[model samples]
Structures are given as structure tokens and as C-alpha cells.
Target: MNHGIEKKARIVGLFLFIGIVTGIFSIAPAIDSTNYLTEVNTNSNQVITAAIFQFTMSLIYLGIAILLYPIVKRYSQSLSIGFLSFRVIAVSLSIVGTILMLSILTLSENYVDVSSNNLLEIETLGNILKSSRDYANHVFMILALCTGNVMLYLVFIKSNLIPKWISFWGITGAVLSIVASGLVLFREIDIITVEYMVLNAPTAILELVLGIWLMLKGFDKRILKADEYENPDSCTLGTIHNG
Candidate 1:
């Protein structure tokens, strides 16, 4: 394996693991509850922690896209660019969701101090913020992520960067993720339900597996060597294979 590629692969894998862990923590149960507006003030610490985790996850998402672009672009520039674009969209939506979460927390703080005469208006605003956060975090953000994963897996399949089976699994998982997000967007299924969880399980599991695989095995050596030959001008410091 090329040392540079090996190092990059491991870094990507590490980012993936961190991103997944942070993503889970970002969904604080208190904030996700139906009575969040009433409860957020009491659970302010949890909400703040969740917001921090969410912002961290967004940074990881962008980092992964940037790191993979140079290598993936060698296989298919258009697909690589598509993957990067979708990742950026996902990150943007995730940041928006984080901001909405913090806004809700602020609203909750104000809720307790407001007079009863203003309670109804405050609750109404809270609900709107909650709904907007839901769409940003669950529906549109997930849709962009799944779309990016599809393009990424397609590149993997074409380039044999990873095993064919792993690529196929990623593609399948991405499709399932998209379906889950679509259902959420259409109001056919709510977030945090068993149905939504079941649909998203595959992609979640695939990412865990892929992260481990990349850390342990890196990209396929053959493909790295071949890509180096085909795109010498873009190649980083790596050994050339004649065989």
C-alpha cells in the first residue's frame, strides 16, 4: 500500500468513527421529546451538549468529503464532485439544525419568564422552530447524505477502491436511507419511530463496518497503483508498481 494513501485512509476512517459517535449524541432525548419547549430549560446542559456534538459532526462531514475528493476524483470527476456537493449540503443543513436547536433552547429559557398572556405565542413559536429543525436534521439533511453516499459508493464500485461486496452494501444502504428520509419528508413516517430506525439501520451499520475496514485494510493497493499511473500529474508521493 502507498504510505500516503494508507495514512489518508486511516484518517478518514477515524473521522467516520468520530462522526458517527457524535451524530448519535447530538440527538439529545430531552430536546427530541414532544414537550421540549417546556423541558429544554430544565435540561439545558443536555441540549447544549447535543448542539456541540452536532457542530462537531458537521465539521467531520465536511472534512471527510474534502479528504476523499482528490482520490475519488481520479476515478470519476463528475461523481466525485457530486459526492462532495451533497456532503456540503448535508453539513449546511446540519449546522442549520444545530442553530435551530440552540434557538429553541433560548426560547425555552424565555418561556419560563414570560407571562401567561404570552405563553400561547411562545409555544407557537417553539413548535415552528421544532418543526423546522426536524426537516433540516431529519429529512433534508439525511437526503443529502444518502445521495452523497450513493455517488461515493458508485465511485468505489467503478474504481474498486474497496471490495465489490462492500461497495454494493454501501449502495444498498444509501438507497434505504434515501427511502427513510423520503418517508419522513412526506409525513408517512415520523422520526424516532421504529419504522424510521429500521430503515436507517443498514446505513448506520455499513458506515461502522466501512470505518473499521478502512482503518485496518485501507484502499485496495492495486487500484491505488493504477490510479497513480493514470493520473501521474495529480499523484502524491507514492511508489509506482510496474507489475
Candidate 2:
């Protein structure tokens, strides 16, 4: 198998696994909602479980992304820098996002458990939930935007390891993510609808496509070693090889 293809397959596997785990966590919230209506205390445990599951999955995904960056870095100079930089940003944002999600889940579960909520107390809780969600979405959206641009630039300008169109799709997905996040934080739109359609699903699909392509085809080792016909940059193909 091509080296890139193998890496892509691993990434696809990781993302798919994340999707499945997240789906399971999503269901827990619905179940907890039902428990809320039925006056059951089971929701707390469920929320805790969901939070743990989500955090674990996110950490695993970040870990895999971090590990892969260095391996891929060696194949192409331009791609290496971009990948490493992205890994740093993604890891940071993702950690913060996970914290927010977990905090929201904790707060929501507690709210559901409370028997009586004063108007002032309810308002405070609402603010907390809203703030947590908003922060998570904002940070994640920015990371997505940066990731998309970096991927596009690396593929289109720095290296030709993967097809140009795949990177383009990544860019599109990133744009949608930004829009979706903005709507969530600024437009008072339905969270589930915008997140599922415009951000999460598309980003996952794009990542899968790109990952598979990379693992199967690997990177173009020569792209990093090439020189521009005129006004070559120091990181240009030829310079990368010698440097």
C-alpha cells in the first residue's frame, strides 16, 4: 500500500470512529431528556458517561492527528510545516472545545435534576450553557477555518501530494463550518440543524476523502524538492531538498 494511503486510511478510521462515538453521545442527551420528563435521576449518570465518551474520542482524534503530522512531515517540506502547525492549533482548540462540551453537559444534567428553578437561577444556568456552547463553537470554527486554508495552500501551492480538488472540498467544508458556527453564536439558529448539516458532517466527509486519498496515493516526494522557474522561495522544492 502507498504510505500516504495508509495514513489516510488511519485518519478515515479515526474520524469514522469519532462520528460513531459522538452519535452515541448524542443519543444519551435525548435519553436524558426523556428521563427529565419522567422525573428520573438517571440523566446525571448518562450525562457523565456522555461527557467522558466525548472527551475520550476527542483526545484520541487529537492524538492521532498529532502523531501523523510528524510522519507526514518527512515526505514533503512544505507539507511538514503546515501539518505540524495545524496539529498544534487543532489540538489546542479541540481541547478547549471538549472542555466546553463537557461543561455544558454537566450543567444541563444538573439543571434537569433540579426540582425547582427560580427565574433568576434559570437565567443564570441558561447563560452558562449558552456561553459554553458559544465559546466551543467559536474556537472550533476558527480552527476549522485555519485548517482548511492550510490544507488548501499546502496542496495547491506548496505540494501536490493529493488532488487539488480534494483540498478545494476541504476549503468549502471549512467555509461552511465558519458559517454554521456564526449562525449558532450570532443568529439564534437551531444548534442541531446547523451543526449537523453545515459543519460536522461535511468536515468529517471531507476529512475522510482527503485522508483516504493521502493514504492511498501518498505524497509527491518531489513536490517539496522542486524550484520555481523564477523568484524561487527558500522553501521551494530544490532548496528544501538541500536544506
Candidate 3:
């Protein structure tokens, strides 16, 4: 519940996520011996490794979320906004996104063995992954809009939990996510498409910034106090006698 501790955890989680993204985009690209599919195949092991690392960092982020939600909810004095409300939505969508991403990774991993393995199975799995990715991205962007930007922003702009600029960035990030995912879905770029790849870093960077900010500074004190009251144990009931 301490803002200081929450900030530290956020920073740690952010740095971990940064490391994972860097490993996937930067380090992974350099490892490929061939430049043809260099973007796709280079340092694949590193990319997979990065995915695993990101997954681990997500778990840490989840922990931070768990600790901070009650504080924000209680302090804010309103369940309409803050950590708990936003997180309930954010986490649900994040789970969907994570699952889709994992499916995509698994299918891509097996694609290399198509000739030696079952071609039909590979194709089927690829379709499933692509569909999941498209759908998940759509839902994820929506979640950002509902939870990160709309709900959290109400608290930030009003409560001063975080700077206005940070809230602005969160809103911007939400919009960008929707747009990027739109380009991928409507334009059919979710699977190795150039448009999706082009928009990837910008969308990711925005989310990175937003995520870092949230981890560093949580919701208002009013929300945190409210959370305590909602716990039931914190409440004291007066004894009554039938007169």
C-alpha cells in the first residue's frame, strides 16, 4: 500500500519488460545468419526467450497490481475508478492476449518443421493462432480504452495520483493501441504483415510508457481507504437490543 514500495516494484517490472522487448527486437534480429527472413527468423531462440521473460515479468506486474489495487480503491473513495476497477478489466484482456501470443509463438515454432511434420496440422494451428492474435489484439485495445485511459484518467486528472502528462500518455497509448490493432485486423496484417510490423514499436512503446507510469505511481489515497472498508473485517457494528 505504500506508494514508495509500489513505485519500486513498478520500476523493476518495467525494466524487466524493457529487457524482454529489447531481447526480442534488438538482440534477436542480429542473431540470424541470413538476412532474407532476418526479420522473421533471426535470433528466434532469443525471441522465444524474450517471450518467456516477458511472461515472467507480467507475473511480477500482476503481483504489483494485486498489492496496489486495494490501496488505490480504498483511497479513492470510489469503486468507479482506480486500480481495482481498471485491473479487473486490464487483466482479463491481458490474459486473452497472452494466450493468443503463446499460440502464435507455438505455431510459428512448428512451422520450421512443416516438411518433416504434418503440413495440415501446421496450417490449422497457424490459422487458429492468427485468429486468436487478431481477436485478442482487438480486445486488448478496448481494455486499454476502458480501464487504462478512461477509468484511470478520471482518477489521475482529479486525484493527482500521477502527473497529468502521464495520464495524457495513457490516453494516447490507448488510442494508438486501437489504431495499430485496427491496421492489423482490418488490413489483414496480423500475420507477418508489413503494416502491423511497422506499427508495432510505436504501439508497444506507448504501452511501455503507460505501464511504467502505473507501476511507479498508483491511484489516490481516497481509493486505498475505501478498499479497507470494503474488506468487511475493517467494519465495526454497534450492538443493538430489541426494546
Candidate with the greatest TM-score versus the true structure: 1
- The CA lDDT of each predicted structure is 0.90, 0.53, 0.51
In the range 1-243, model 2's lDDT, one tens digit per residue, is 233334554565556456455635733443224223222234556655655775665566555555455434444656656655665565566556556555555555566667584535854765665456445545453555456345544544444555677767666777666666666657566555545465756666776665555445545544533422232543354345434
Task: Report model 1's TM-score to 2 decimal places.
Answer: 0.95
What clash count does candidate 1 reach? Answer: 0
Model 3 residue runs over 4 Å out of place are 1-44, 75-89, 92-118, 137-146, 188-243
Lowest summed lDDT over 10 consecutive residues: which window, candidate 2?
A: 31-40
Tens-place lDDT per residue, model 1, 112-174, is 999999999999999999999999999899999999999999999999989999999998988
Residue-level lDDT of model 3, residues 1-243, one tens digit each, is 334434544664465366446434422232222321223343456546644654554555455456444334433546434555555555465556556555555555566656856866866766665566446535453445345445545555665666677667666655655666665567555434465555455545655665665555544445444543575443222111111
Q: How many residue pairs collide in each prediction?
A: 0, 11, 17
For model 2, the stretches where C-alpha displacement exceeds 4 angstroms are 1-42, 71-89, 101-119, 138-157, 194-196, 215-217, 220-243
Minimum summed lDDT over a 10-residue window in model 1 is located at: 234-243
Model 2 residue 191 distance off true place after TM-score fit, in angstroms: 1.2
TM-scores for the candidates: 0.95, 0.62, 0.56
The best candidate by lDDT is 1
Ranking by lDDT: 1, 2, 3
